[model samples]
Target: MRSAPDDDRPGRVIPFGKGRDRAYDAYGHAYDADEARGDHGAERRVDHLTRFMDFLRRRVAGDYEVDEFGFDPELTDKVTLELMRPLYRTWFRVETLGAGDVPAESGALIVANHSGTLPLDALMLQVAMHDEVGRPLRLLGADLVYQLPVLNHLARKTGHTLACREDADRLLRKGEAVGVFPEGFKGVGKPFSERYRLQRFGRGGFVASAIRAGVPIVPCAIVGAEEIYPKIGDLPVLARILGLPYLPITPLFPWFGPLGLIPLPSKWMIEFGEPIRTDDYDPGAADDPMLVFNLTDHVREIMQQMLNELRLRRGHAFPPLF
Candidate 1:
């Protein structure tokens, strides 16, 4: 999410090469370079389509970059910390409650409540760590995100990979910080009726990942995102037809027509809670249903308490962004 240089402008579209379902452009090089420079811009759509198509064809034809999605430490640092500065300034007024608990070295599982209709909480947290605390946090993005054309490129460029034990263990074992929303898509899809009320977390995927890697679990709470795009209702049939996961009727969107997806600019607050040491648990503890349940319950409870406290401290349900 790094800032784009003045020279970086959105590119033109190109037709898909003969019979191909998608087109292509030279976008990945810029993407990688921008990430290295922490630059953000409207993705060169053609570039992504081209690269993806090439990747697909090559993979099917048995030739591709052997290390296609491998992590580039330096580039990731630039992208997450630098490019995303504008977003951090405009949307979130973030505060970390227990940044001190994050260790200087090694990987940790940052278990956080998923709010903000569009995953802005995670973006804000990444900027907070990179800009304020001087560390870069990699998010464990959902599989759905990777399905989008340009979004998938951005996610990979910004250091987000899939959320799974193998990826988590590999990254953690390599000494990189990983963020996970235990609530997954369910938390994000929770009705506006249940805003800020945490959904059920699966039994300890995050906790187990941490224990196996011997890292602490940092409980994080994000407030203000729930109200950003207050989803009041959904159109399931249309959503399915359009291939969109959910079609939200926000105050701005369906109510305001073209303006619906335009999030009413609201001041946001994000807080990072204390780290719970999972390293102390026996390696086999991940399988103990009772243990996972207790940990999941504890995280949910802490997030709820933090949400309430943040709501009270802020003293308003929503604040004007401008």
Candidate 2:
């Protein structure tokens, strides 16, 4: 009988075969061939853990700054935004157009249509600005966002505050990019049948805010978010009880439990239109009702037109074109 081959040898033959032996001995330290192959995955996990520890150390050592609103740039960039990047890149496969239209240095307002039962669109836009435009977007969110416990904390750390004129003006005056979804709950909770139909922007408040701050309004149109979780219906009573706008009824949700909440992978395209300057208008233009309405309508029209064009380019929301 042939002597048993040494299991620790790199090229040692085993009963399984030469290929199996090589794989089993790939990590040299392990005495058992079976254990060596299993260590590969553990090794990768160790590497990830090590990097994460380093990141935390930097944050804890005052290498990062947190703004008054609790916006921690380092944590948001390294941890929170990093977690969302895979979804933005691989799942949604977001394609950006007219990124240059966004002002690199000056303060500006980003006005966009909002949809998707969850405010995933907002998070994705945040990723886009950070990764593509190379700027941190300060988003103005609704009261509901700040009312939730854990969510409120994360939202602030990610640079979102209550959607009030005061907050918007403050951010803009500081030369920070501000984003607002004028449609509010009306656009987000609409039925699937009404998808992509722009809702009435609330009182042109965003327009007034932009005018007062003397910043340009950049119309942003996003396609593919409408289909994420098709809102077939809603339960108003439950929503009221839960203090939510509406209890969304998607195909899988409320029926399949938590597993159904997974969003369908949709191809996303975000385009920024040419900036509409507010500098020419008088300072009082913000207070003028008619002026605010006209400018609001103008931004809405531009977004709608862009939506139509993007929809035409992307044929189907699912099976999105690369």
Candidate 3:
């Protein structure tokens, strides 16, 4: 038999050996050699906590600007968005295509498909544009978003406002990039079978807004959000009672209780297509129904095509496109 190996390694030594019992103290407590060692993980957490507290102090001191719509860039960047960063980067593993296509300076309209049951896609897009494109995207939200007291306050702080032509035009005129989901509740509340299908673009109002603002329209196709929730059914009666558009019933939701509320860890892709310049069209062209309709149809077609291409690239929703 070979001689017993030396226990002289760099780190603390464990007591147990080939045949020896654990080393114990007089009180019968086994000696733990590593107990006094520092934990790197704890050290890292303390560093992060220190940074976050500093950020909060700056915010509380009013060291940030707030826009007319109640957008607080400092608070959003330091707090609200920081909370979503892990989800966007780690959980969803969001990948962006054509992010460079987004105009670096001038205003533009970003129109994307909406799903994911909880509007988490919008939050992800906000993070993506801010992180990858180096620009803050002002989102156009539904009235329902503003009706909820706490959510409304948070939405405004995160740079989201009512999705109407007035707000859209205002933001664009101010040289702010605006994001809109024309599908609204229709796309978000649709069944899983209808996933990736482009719904009606809602009378081309967004196109008209873009035209009036003389900004380019950038069609965005977001994949993976549809599978996150996977709406299998709806409870219209309960929805009516609750004043919601539709009560979504996902496969895991309402069955697994609170645990089911967590979204599936699906890979996400957000691709921005080339901009469609509305500057080429006369401003008065916005008043033309046919013109708006044609532009809307064109945008819808472009987004749909991009979605299909991204889907092919993705290959699967669960494993994601790594």
TM match of model 1 to true structure: 0.73
Candidates' lDDT values, in order? 0.66, 0.82, 0.82
Per-residue error for 71 in candidate 3, Å, reads 0.4
Cα lDDT, model 2, residue 48: 44
Model 2 worst lDDT run, 10 consecutive residues: 11-20
Write down the lDDT that model 2 would get: 0.82
TM-scores of all candidate predictions against the true structure: 0.73, 0.83, 0.83
Worst 10 residues of 1 by lDDT: 12-21
The deviation in Å at residue 223 for candidate 3 is: 0.4
Off by over 4 Å in 3: 1-54, 320-322
Q: Where does model 2 exceed 4 Å of error?
A: 1-54, 61-63, 320-322
Q: Mind giving the per-residue lDDT tens digits that candidate 3 earns over 1-322? A: 1112222322211221111134332211243435314565575455446645544554566554577999876667656766898999999999988988999879999999998788889999998887778678899999999999899989998888998888999999998899999999988788999999988888789999999999999999999899889999889899999999998889898899998899999989999999999999899999999999999999999999999999889877877243
- Candidate 2 at 211: error in angstroms? 0.9
Tell me model 3's lDDT, rounded to 2 decimals.
0.82
